[model samples]
Each structure stands twice: as structure tokens, then as C-alpha cells.
Target: MKPSDLDPVVDALEAELRPYRDSHHTYRRLPSGGRDRREILDEMRELASREEAKWRAGYSSGAVYHGSADHIEFLNEVYAVNSQSNPLHPELWPSAVKYEAEVVAMTATMLGGGEEGVPTVCGTVTSGGTESILLAMRTYRDRARAERGVAEPEIVVPVSAHAAFDKAAHYFGMRLVPVPVGADWRADVAAAEDAVTKQTVALVASAPGFPHGVIDPVEELSELARRKGIGCHVDGCLGGFVLPWAERLGYPVPPFDFRLPGVTSMSADTHKFGYAAKGSSVVLYRSSELRRYQYYKTATWMGGLYYSPTFAGSRPGAISAEAWAAMLAFGEEGYTIATKALLETAAVIRAGIERIPELRVLGDPLWVIAFASEEIDVYAVMDQMSARGWNLNGLQHPPAAHICVTLRHAQPGVAQRFVADLEASVADVRHMPGSQGVMAPIYGMTGAVKTRGTVEELLARYGDLQFKA
Candidate 1:
């Protein structure tokens, strides 16, 4: 599209992103006096009432992993009890220490750790999956510098890995080598082997990538890592909580954790499928010796002896408490049940997509489902799905769309409605003549924009519009 085409497309997006601007009061400056507590609560509640139903009724994809009212209320209670707690000062609140320690232990145990006389897997709780990935990458970089005397460190990551790996490479000033996946959308082991060099400190494989929902050949990748004497980090941020239960339920989940000799570290999100509240994740290392590199300490500081395990100095202990509480509430039995419902729902949705003559499923993904079509415009179909209140994700590269099936979709009638609405969406897009949706032109022009600076500028401008207040 021309520059003129992008302007109107951006204007429409700005309108949708700022829907609350006209309805609510914008606080550009402080008022002389504070508002009443009840009035503020009522106003926030009113907005939540208008917005909660989309995810509540399973119209969304992956935004709300476990949206049960009772679970949310339980997490809220846990957060409330530890609202004043901060993990930075363990002396002030010993319970915060226990919460974080147990959270890490439980997560590690779930992912092939916490056994007697094992390699002694240990880790620290981070803000989220992004921070976990960043911390692990930085730790490996620093470890290489100290132990191997390699000043210039690099990490080999699959192209289908999460964007956080790119962010980690940028922020840590390390080289990132992207290896393309095979036809099945999983990482190609031979290509990854070629990408590694003497300077390579770590290798990354996603346990079910974000875009295509295909797990890489981690067994082979980890074996390669073992031979090359480098660390292997499995990004289980998406499938960490669900895959173990899925395997127990008879899904063919490959080994992607510390059980393998080459697997040195991993990251998992408690906020996603662990049913915990947002803002909690675990990054585990094979041993406390390796994890020690991730910590920061300085006795010479004027601010007194300081040490922070993760990125943030004063972290929210309440979120860690919520994660711990959530894990205990949903033990093995609860997770197995939730996994059953979620997988069953996902199978239905995937089959429904396969039944559509125009659409083609990307891979043999278990939960997250991506489908594309050579017959019709996929973004147009996504637009129609959006019109029907179906919130799905749009993919690039091959131009596809996916839905991360969660407990939200396990609700009664949601799976059936999604299939019915998707069939209608494809039909509507098939009959429609020209590209005429908000995303249609945007995606079309973005795919055509080969200039990196132009694409960055366009995205930056769109993000700026989101903050117009």
C-alpha cells in the first residue's frame, strides 16, 4: 500500500485502542484533592464490567489462560494477604522468601528437577517469561566471559523462538544466530548445528514455539549442545505447565527439560497455564553453581550490602505468593483435569479448522492451532472473526492466524461457537471481493515493506497513537 493507505488504517486502529479515552477521565495532571475511594473503585469496576466478558466467555485467545471466577478470587486473596511484602528484604518478611523458594522448587520439580541426589536444579523467580529469558541469556553470557575467557559471546536460537530472545540479545550486547525451522515448523537440527561456533555460549529451543505451536527437536539440539560443551536453554514459557500433564494424558511430548544431560536451563511462565496471576515465572538452572552467575552482589555499595537475584531489586512478593498459592490449589489432579478439558477443546477446534476446505492447519500442534489458506485472504478472515467477537492472533511470514487454546475455550459452547463462527468468517471473507478490513491493508503493506527502518517507524507511530490519552 501507499503512504496514503497507511494513514487511514492507523486512524482506525487508534480509535479502537483508545476507546476508554472518551469514556473515562484522563489523569494528565494531579487534582488538588484526591477522589473518594468508593467512587474510584466504582469507576474501575464499571470499566472492567464492560471489558471482562470477552475473555470470560472464551472469545479471546491466550490472554486469560485460566479464567475461572473462583480461581481468580483465590489468587486475589493470596495477593491481598501479601500486598505489603517485598522480596528484596527477606528479613522483613520471611514468608516472602518461602513463597518464592517454594514457587521455584515446585516449578523445577514439575520440569524434571527437585529429586534427591540429582544435579540440584535451582533458580530465582523473575517478573515474567521475558525477564526469565533475559536473565538466563545474560547469565550464560556472563558465565562465558568469566569461565571461558570469551569476550564476544553468542547464542543460537531457532527462528520460531519467542521475541524475548531477540530482546535479550539486543539488551545484553550479544550476537544471536537465528536458525530456520524445517518444513514441519520445528527447528532444523542440522542448521542449528551449523550456526554454533566456538564463541557460542548457549543454544535455545522452544517447547512449542509461539507462532506455529511446534516443539523443536530438543532431544537432538540438547545432544548437540552436550557434544559442543555449551548450555542448552529450553523455552517452555508456553507449554511448561501443560506439557507434563499432556504427556501424562498420553500426548507425545519430547524431552525438553533438565532430565536430559545437555539441558542446563529452562524458563516457564506461571502466569500462563499455571493458573497463577500475571507477573510471575521461573528460570531454572541445572545447579546452584550455574544459577549463582545470575545474581548481583556488592558489599562496597554506599547503599549498604546489596544483592538482587533477578532484574528487579524490589520485586512484588504478592505475585510470588499468588503463584505459590495457585500451585498448591491446583495440584497434580487439578492440572490433569484442566489439561484434559483444554486439550479436548483444542482438538475440536483444530479438527474444525481442518474441516474447512479453504484453510490448512500449519502443523500437528496439540493446543495452539494455526491455520492458513491459499484460497482466500487470511487477514480478511481474521477481520471477520474479529467482527464476530473472536479474538485470534495474526501471524506473519507465511501470513497465518492462530488461537492458543486455554481453559477459557473449555467453557461450554465456546468450542462449538468458535468453529461455527470461524466457518462463517471464512465464508464471509470468501464472498467479499476486495481487501477492506483494518488489518487487511496493514498486514498487506507490512509484508511488502522490505525496508527495516520504514517498518519500525510505522510500528512506532502506531504505538505512539496508543498513548494519546
Candidate 2:
């Protein structure tokens, strides 16, 4: 069947799931005029149990990190201890300030902040990686407007940078100049240099971009931005915690942090490889002066003085506390051990994928391994793996799938199972002639479509189904 034919099937499946979408924990008034907490708790627990398996067994990619029972319990305890704390009212919860400050400091140090005379790098705790990236972009935008009088600002970014950069550009009203990546999947520094103009506010480089897991040439790109008198934002959300330890473990890591003189700001997610609980990340600036541009303050408000360091006000202090606890609990030694396991597991997976006859690994990656096949449909293989109870990330432009090795994948027999299953999947695809799985057809249509508007409309319909309940 054609790819568009499967759209009806997908729409039907979405409609089927609509009834259960928002009915997971519906609150109804009781005859006794009180809610039933026990029933609600049971429903919530059931939902969690039903959804935990794929990620729990390490079949998924980079979603849940450090799923150990002890680690989760420790983080839960920390969060429970500070459940009532709010950073907005620092006087009420002084501990929030301490945790927030320490989290930023520890994250900065890990990302090569205080190595040299870097002037005690400062930052604020953000909600997540998107906020961190958004705040950095907004800071550059405002700083350029104030200092350089750049009204119509433009941000030079590699095509492989995170989608959040595009979100930042839209939110801050800045023009985004996307520089194409080279054959190696790294950003083209010369292309970025050519894209920059007087209205250019900042340049962006990613340390191991999300799609292909290739790091941009930060040293060259940042220097280009610096010479052009524009800001450079290094997106280390993926590699910030892992790469530092990977470098110390003697991996070939490029210079992609504040260590580069031209790197003015960076976004790193503590929730990711840092092993913190979700909803926590840090955005660091080269100096407090640059950070001030990211802050919001108003004295003319009807309510007294109001200020927010990052995007959100009255943020979840519990998540911040959990992030701090995770970092402190897993100090440098702990991170080093985790990083070693992750890198070693990634190496094993990479080698196994390379051994497969039909498949080729994309670029040279540490943990995130993207592989494509020349003999069989890669999406068909992905569907086969999915049927076998595995969840992997699908990539386009080259039609590949990736398995982001996390601690779960490092478990005994997990890597071997992945390789064995992948081999079986490829064999199945080779033998099954003219076969296209559900996603294969979809991806095929996506590739062949000339108008993106139709695809976007389909996406919007999918979103509507998600909220149909």
C-alpha cells in the first residue's frame, strides 16, 4: 500500500486511543462529597506500569537514563523533602537558593568553566534543555540590541542544531540563517562565516548534534563569530556531561565548551547524562554581564518588584532539588564510572553494527549510534525491531535508525540482544520482497512530498487526536 493509505490506519488508531487519553485519572465528585484518593492512586500506578517496560529494558533511546531502583528512590526522597519549597519565595525556602546555585556551579565546572581564569562562570537553573537553549538565544538577541543596536537580529546556526534553536528564533523574532553541514555531518565553518552579517546576533554550534551525533567545529566556528563581533552559543545539552568525562577517559573529544575563548554561552541538561531527574537543566554564560541580558526585571508592575532569572517564574523547586541531589550523589568519581560504562557499551554496539554486512554506521559517534542499510529498507528493519519490543529513533535525510546507549543498554546481554535482533531484522527484510512496514511507507511519503504544508496538516490532525479525549 502507498504511504498515504497508512494515514487512514494511523488516524483510526489515534481515534481508538482517544477514549483512554485523558481518562487515566478522571476526578468525579463522590456521594460522600469527597474524592477517592485510593482509586486515583491505583489508576496512576497502573498507567506507569503499563508504560515503563520499553524504556526499563533499555530498548528505547536516551529518554530514561539511570533507571536503577536505588537512584530513583534517592531522587524521589530528595524531591519529596523539597516538595513544598519554591524558589520564587527565597526567604521561605533558603534551601532552594542553595540547591539552585550549587546545581549551576557543579554543572558549569563539569563543562570546563573554571579551568583557567574564566572569572568564576555564572548561570541559572532552567527547566530543561529547551529553556536553556531559548534563554541563551534570547540573551544574545537582547545583548545585541542593547550594545550593538541590532534591531533586526539574525542567528547563524548549523542545520544539525536542535529544533529548539528554531523555536528560539520564532519566539525572539530573530532571523535564523541555517548553514549546511559537511559530508561528515559537522557544521561548515566557512558557510557559517559567509552567512553572518551585521545583523547577526549569535552563532550556534552543537557538541554532538542530536540527529547524526556529530559535533560541529566549535573552535573554528566560535572564533569566526568572535572575529565577526557576534556571540557564539555552544549547545552541549547532549555532550555536556558525558563528553567531559569521555575526554578524561582518553576519548578524542574536540574543544566544544567555555574553554574556547569565543564560546560565550552554553546549554547543558543535567536531566540527561548528568543522571538528574527530569525537568532540570543549566544555561551558563561566560560572564555575569552577559547573563544579565537573559534576566527579566520590572519595577513598574502593579505588583511590587518582579524578576525571573530564566524563562519561568515560580518554577518547580522540587525538580531543582532533585537535580542538585543527583549531582551531589554522583560526584566526579560516580560520573566517571557512568561515562566509562556508557562509552564502552557504545563501542560494543558500534562494533556489532559495523559487523553487519548490509548496514553502515553514520559518522564516528561515542554513545549515539546511527546506522543505515544499503541492501534493505532501514525503516522496515526498525519496524521489525519495534515488533520485537524495541523502540529506536528514526532519522531522515539519509534514512537511518539510532540506538542511544544508556545505562540500561549497558546491562548484561542487552548489547548482545540488540546485535542479534538487528541481524535477524535485516535478514527478515532481505527475504521479504517488496515489503514496507507501517513507518516505512510513512517515511517514504515524507521523503517524496514536495509540499510540506500537507505533512504539517497531517501532524496537526495527529495532535488533535491526542487530545480528543
Candidate 3:
């Protein structure tokens, strides 16, 4: 739809959703007139109860990895214990340093770092996956500018790579060159090699990309970058905590980590699969020299010499402690068992999807699977699922949907419930001839538009809706 057409649709949506939006608590500033603490806590608990079922019952995708009540309680306790600790002042809070350092070390070791006298494979804890990716991209841009004298640096990334890479390119003043994936939904190594030029600073590949959950051919892409004397970044944000354990459980996992000779940096999210509280991830570098480019140090400041390793100065030490506690609590054995259950559950879902004649799985994914329907409109199917209390992710371009299986899905009958709901949804969508569901029009608009500006404007308006009250 054109801009003029979109205004009416948006107005209609706002009118329909205004009641629910008004009651939802987007922020809770200290109760002005002094409400009881117990009352406030109860209100928050009620909100959580309202939002928990979609994720806890395995109807949602990839938001909560380990959603057990006991695990959350333990992590919350860990966070409470270190709530006052600050890593910026190590002298004051030595425990914060210990937690942050150990979190990085453990994450690095999992991702094939510190294997062969690699100087302990140094890194720093960041806010989340986006910061980790941003730091690595900035490091490559700075390294290329200093060593290769490439002023206008560019980074070649697969079309399946995370949006964070594009954000990094925009923030760091580097050109982002996106190469398309092949029919199998993996990055095209030949196209990536063709896209690289003298100005290219790095090549990026995801262990298991977010959109379709297919692992890129990192070995081939990184080797190409190596031959061209540029950096190679392996994005293991979604897979870093699962792939190693999956490989140990006899899954056919590929080489997409520091074990590859061409991989110079990597980003891994502790908050996602590490079962930690949100706001923690690690960014590892092959060498201290390369990581130095990611640091910020200035000596001539009036506030005394200022230097920070990651993006933030005074980071949340509590989240760092929670991440450390999670890693140590769930040792190698704990992770292996969790990964095994997750993959087994995913297999069940995958098999069920394949049995349905209307839909087909995208790729040979382990835990995260994307499926598309050749017979029916997938978005309408997604809408049907949503009506049945399922919150699945919607994909464009090829018009597909995905569900990232977690430990919650491994519960007794969650997988069976998902399959039943999916079958029913497909049948409902098929029966409702020419029904344009809620999200169908939006997805259609996105896929049919030639210029992205219209889509971006719609997204901006969508963002504006969040602040309506």
C-alpha cells in the first residue's frame, strides 16, 4: 500500500488495540504517592504470569531457552547476590572481575578458543549479542584502516547474517555488502568470494543464522577471506552454546568457530542458551593485538585517563555474575543433556512438519527449523496458530515461519501439542478461502514492495505504537 493507504490501516489498528495497550505497563516509575512494596511486586508478578504461558508452554520461538522455574530462581538469586558489584572498580568489587573474566574464559573455551597456546583467547563481557557483533565489526574496520590503509572499508556478509551486522556497518561507517544464500538456504561461498574486493575489511558467516536457522559454509567463506588477507567473523550467537554439545551428541555439526584457521573473531550470546539472565554476551579475538582495536583509551582527558574494553563503561555486574553462575552450575554434562533433549524435540517437530503435504522444512536444521507451505499462504497459517495461543515467528522473502526449539519444548507433551496445533492451523487456513488474516496483509506488502523505504516507514510507525500511552 502507498503512504496514504497505510495511514488508514494504522489508524484502524490503533483503534482496535488501544484498550490493551493502555493497560500494559511499559514502565513503572517509583510509585508517586508510595504504594506498598508488596502491592507493586504483586502487580509485576501478575504481568509475568500473563506473558509466561506462550513461552513456557513452548508455543513461542527462541525467546526463553531454559525456562524452568528452578533455573530462573537460581539465576535471580545469583543476580541479587552481586547486584552491588561493579566491574569498572575492580579494587572495590573483586568479585565482579572474577565473574566477568571467568564468563569470557568459559565461553571462549566452548567456541574453540584457547586450544593451542592461543594466549588464553582473551575477550570481554558485553551487554548482549548486538554489542558483541558490533565490537567485532568495529575491530575489523579499525584493524583494516591501520594495517592495510583501507580508508573506505567494507564488510561482506551473507544475506542470512543477523541485522546486527548491518547496524554495525551503519554505526562504524563501513560499507555492508550482502551476498545471497543458495537454494539450500546456506551462504553462497562463490558469491561471497566474488563480492570481496580490496576495500573489503572482513567476511561474516553465521554458525546458524537467525532467519532460517541454517549454518553457513563458514570454512569455505573464511578460507576465502584468509587468502585475501582480511578478517573473518563467525557469528555463533544462536549456536555457540548448542552446537558444541550437539556435536558431542553425535549430530553432524560443521566447523564454524575459532578452530577454523581463517576465523579471526567470534560473537557468542551467554544470555540466549547459556541459560543466564538477559544482558550478557562475549566477543573473542584471535590475538590481543587485534582486540586492541576494539578498545577505547584516551590519556589527555581532564577526567583522568579513561579506557573501556567493551562498549559500556560501568556494565551490569549482576548479569555478569548470573552468566558465570549459570555456566558453572550447568557444567559440560548439564549442557550436553540439555542439548540432547532440545535436538530430540526439534527432530519430532521436523518430522511432523514433513508429514504435512502442504508444508516443507527449509533445511536440515538441528534445533531451529523454518518451514514453508507450497499449498497455502504461510502467514495465514501463522495467524491461525496465533489464534490457538501459539506465537511463532514469521519470515519473508520466501514467506516461511520458524520455531526455535528449547528445553521448554522438550517437556512431556509440548512437541505433540505443537504438532497437533500446527495440523489444525493448516486445516483451518485451508478451509477459510480467500481470508486475509491480521498479519497476512503486512507480510504481503513487505514481500511485494520493490522499494524498502515503504516497509521501513511502516516499521517506524509500528515502533511509534509502543509509545502511544
What local distance difference test score does each model get? 0.89, 0.86, 0.87
Model 3 residue 400 distance off true place after TM-score fit, in angstroms: 0.8
For model 2 the local lDDT of residue 466 reads 67
Q: Rank the candidates by lDDT, best first.
A: 1, 3, 2
lDDT of 2 by residue, 344-444 (tens): 98899999999999999988888888998778889889888987888888887778988888999989889989999999998888999556555554453
What candidate 1 gets wrong by more than 4 Å, as runs, is 1-5, 116-119, 443-450
RMSD of each: 1.5, 2.5, 2.2
- Give residue 203's lDDT in candidate 3 (0 to 100): 96
Query: What C-alpha lDDT, on a 0 to 100 scale, does residue 367 get in candidate 3?
Result: 80
User: TM-scores of all models?
Assistant: 0.97, 0.94, 0.95
Best by TM-score: 1
Report the C-alpha lDDT of model 1 over 289-339, residue by residue, as the tens digit: 899999999999899989999889898999999999999999999999999
Error of 3 at 223 (Å): 1.0
